[model samples]
Target: MTVALVTGATQGLGLALVEGLAQRLDPTDTVYLTGRDMNRVMTAVESMPGGGAEVRGELLDVADHQAAQRLAQQIRERHGGIDIVFGNAVMRVGPDDDPRVIADQYTEVNNFGTTRLLRAFAPLLRDNGRLLVVASSLGTLHHLAPVLHDRFTTPSSLDEIDEQIARWRDELKDRRTGAWPAFVNIPSKIGQVAAVRVLAAERREDDLHRGILIASVCPGMINTPTSALWWNVSTAPTPAQAAVALLDLALDPVKPEHHGELVRFGEVVPFS
Candidate 1:
């Protein structure tokens, strides 16, 4: 059976992804809907159209190392391996949030949280499995300083990417030479996209040849609660619309040109 996992799926695009996957995947396939809160996960599962027979809520807090590892172990022991992994969990640091707290939370959840999922579940991904991390267009490489962009796009390894995140966070917290609090999400998202690119490149010879596809995806300016809270409302697509694009990436046959690329609006975009 095709076993899929979607993290931070209690609401917004993540929740919509669960429904979309259920509708498209084989009837017997299982979709693991996960969130940091069990109450929300259970409520989401209960509200699905089929009462979620094909979906099960799994609690996961991407920033919690032990929680992530435990979930990975549980999935490995229960299902043998994972076929599709959607790293959808994220933390939004707005302009009003404290700079120190913003640096701490955004880096921990958006940057490290995504890496945690990839590192832990990557091993459990069966041949032909797909890994997609949710990124934002604002986080594109061009949005970063040249040096930072270069570091992200051409990282030698995942460790290098992590180091870059650490350095960026340090700068963010620095008064003399630091980033603005409003732009906290950009670095974290950039780090995520870069890490995915590095991983896709690193695993290409062995994993890609064996049918594994790893890449980062941008869902566009989705009209969710998170968006409304942070930015001016616009004619952005609903969470369901964004989910359609993400589910397509998750289930469609992988194209060589799409591997290691940032997929935005359902097309492969230049990483830089």
Candidate 2:
């Protein structure tokens, strides 16, 4: 039986992802939808249409490392391994938000959270499995200053990524924002993509032998509570529409060229 998991699946793009998976996966396939709130998670699962994949709501806070580990272990015990994982949990902060809060929230929920999920579930991916981290077009290399490109594109180790985040935090403390991207989300998403690249590199042998694909995806602009926090979404695609591309990426067979790259609509986006 196919087993899949979507983080932050209670609402918006995440919720849409679970719904899409439900519609597409077979009845015997199982999909775990996770959120920080158990009530909301169950509610979302109950709201899904019947006669699709077996949907289960799970209480998961991607920012909580132990919580992620426990859930991964539970899934491993029950299902042997997961076939798909969509890293959809994220935090969005704007200029009006406190810099201190922004630094902490964005790093904890967006950047490191992606790292936590990868660490927790990556090894449990079955052969020919797929893992897609839902990043954004805003994470493009052009969004960052030239000097920072090499650091993100070179695929640093997870510990090195942590150090880079620490360095960013220090820069924020010193009020040296000029060296970083204008918005914290850019660097945060970049870190997510970088982490994916690192995992892909670390698992090169697995990619060749097992046909596993791990990459970050940009879902494009969508009308979601998260995007509404930043810009006008009146004309943006609905969450369901955006979820189409993401689900396509997650369900498609491994494409050797696309592994480790940041992709949108089946195309590789330049990292630098």
Candidate 3:
């Protein structure tokens, strides 16, 4: 049976994705909805219209590396491998927030957390597996410092990307002003996009075994509790509208040229 997993599926864009994906999957297929809170997970599963039997719920906190590993093991044992993975989990820290604290949590959850999940699940992706990382336009290169913008857009070795992340963390910890607080989400999102490129390249360089497509996409400004706090929620697109593009990426036929690229408004755009 085909198995698909959606991280941070409790509400907003993630929840919309789960519903859209569940409706399309075959009766025998399973779509797992995951979040950090079990109550939310259960509630989301129960609330889906028509009560999708194929949809299930699990507790997953992307920031918790051990939990990711454990969940990966469970999926490996139970399903052998997964067909699709929508890395929809994300965090935004703003308002009444300490620069250091918000920066730390944002980096931990958005950048490190995503990469950790990818590493944990890479082995468990079956041939031709697809991964879609839910990214944001706010994380664009122009939002980053010049050097970092170059690194992210031009594509660099994973080690170099790690160095950049370390530098960012240090800058935040040292309380360096200017770029630190203004562009909090850029580093992690940039790292995630870079990670997608790295993964795609690795798959290409390795001996032809299985075809795994890795890609990151920015769903534009979506109206969600998270975005409401960060931006003018009134002007943002509905979660359903944003989710359509994401769902299209998740379900569409894989195109090799599109692999490792960042999609915006359903089109491939320059990383910069």
Candidate 4:
């Protein structure tokens, strides 16, 4: 029986991803959807169409390290290991938001949250499993200043990424943020992609030999409440439409070349 998990799946693209997975996975397969609140998680699961895969809900605040670790252990014990994981939780900061607050929320939820998920769940990926992180095209290294590229791309450990995020947060708090991109999401997304790259490289041999694939993906611009918070979504694809590409990457045959890369519409996007 295939077991899959999607974090922050109460609504928007995450909800769409869960729905798509339910429809595609076999009836015996299980899909777990998570959100910060139990009510919202259960509500989302109840609202999904029935007679697909078995859909369940759980409370998961991706920013909580211990929470992620506990859930990972629970899944490992209950199902032996998971077949797929979609790291869909993220925080988006608006232009009007305070820089200091953005620094904290974005780094905690978007950057370090990704790290926590990777730490907790990556090791439990069964053979032929897949782990796909929801990043964005804006996450490209080119979006960051030239001086920061090497630091992001060549991180020796996940802790290095965490340290870099902490340094950026400190700079924002100290009002010494000249080196960072004007928008906090840029660096936040870059950090997420960087974490995925670091993990993929660190596990390259094992992943290849075991037929596992890990990747970061950009779903392109999508019309969702979160996008409405920051951009014009009138012309953007709907969440269900954007989900097609993400679900494709999650369910399609594992591609070794796509491992450790940022993908969009099934194509590898240059990190630089």
Q: Best candidate, TM-score-wise?
A: 4
TM-score of 2: 0.95
Off by more than 4 A, model 1: 51-53, 176-182
lDDT of 1 by residue, 1-272 (tens): 99999998999999999999888887788999999989999999997887332999989998897777899999999889999999999886555787665777778888888888878988898988998998987667677667555667657788888888888777767743433334667777778888888888878877768788888999988887668878765788899988888888888887777787789866887767
Q: Sort all candidates by TM-score, best to worst.
A: 4, 2, 1, 3
Better by lDDT, candidate 2 or 1: 2
TM-scores, one per candidate:
0.93, 0.95, 0.89, 0.97
Better of 2 and 4 by TM-score: 4
Tell me the lDDT of candidate 1: 0.82
* Model 3: how far residue 146 lies from native, Å: 2.3
Better of 1 and 2 by TM-score: 2
Error of 3 at 54 (Å): 1.0
Candidate 1: residue 189 Cα off by (Å): 1.1
Q: Count of backbone clashes for each model? A: 0, 0, 0, 0
Query: Which residue pairs in candidate 1 collide?
Result: none
- On a 0 to 100 scale, what is the lDDT of residue 153 in model 1? 62
- Report the poorest 10 consecutive residues by lDDT, candidate 4: 92-101
lDDT of 4 by residue, 35-90 (tens): 88899999999999887799989889988868889999999889999999999998
